[model samples]
Target: MCEANAYVRQDGVEELFLEGVDKVVPMDNQLYLENIFGQKKMIAGTIKELSLVDHKIIIEKI
Candidate 1:
């Protein structure tokens, strides 16, 4: 229930990146995201915003 959906912001638009993301790990210059279903992704970006109440996470891709 604490999982959050992830989004990537580009050109002022936000796009869904991952859903139900429960884990986020910073490795080097990228972020490692893991979802509750064990889905994973590595994205090169910085966190823009985190809305816990909305269960959303926004990242600005570099």
Candidate 2:
């Protein structure tokens, strides 16, 4: 329940990228997102914001 949903901010809008994200790993200039269900997504981007209270993780694509 502590897990947060990840979003990608684009053109002044936030789009949901992943739900129940548990971890984020950065390697080889790419970001790896792992959800509670072990679903993974790798993308080229930078972390923009972490709103723990709101349970949101925002990323901006490179």
Error of 1 at 30 (Å): 0.4
TM-score of 1: 0.95
Measured by TM-score, how close is model 2 to the native structure?
A: 0.93
Model 1, 7-48: lDDT tens per residue? 999999989999999999988879999999999999998898
Clashing pairs in 2: none
Q: Name the regions of candidate 1 deviating beyond 4 angstroms.
A: none
Candidate 2 per-residue lDDT, tens place, 1-62, comes to 88999999999899999999999998876789999998999989999999999999999999
Each model's lDDT comes to 0.94, 0.93
- TM-score of every candidate: 0.95, 0.93
In model 2, the worst 10-residue window by lDDT is 22-31
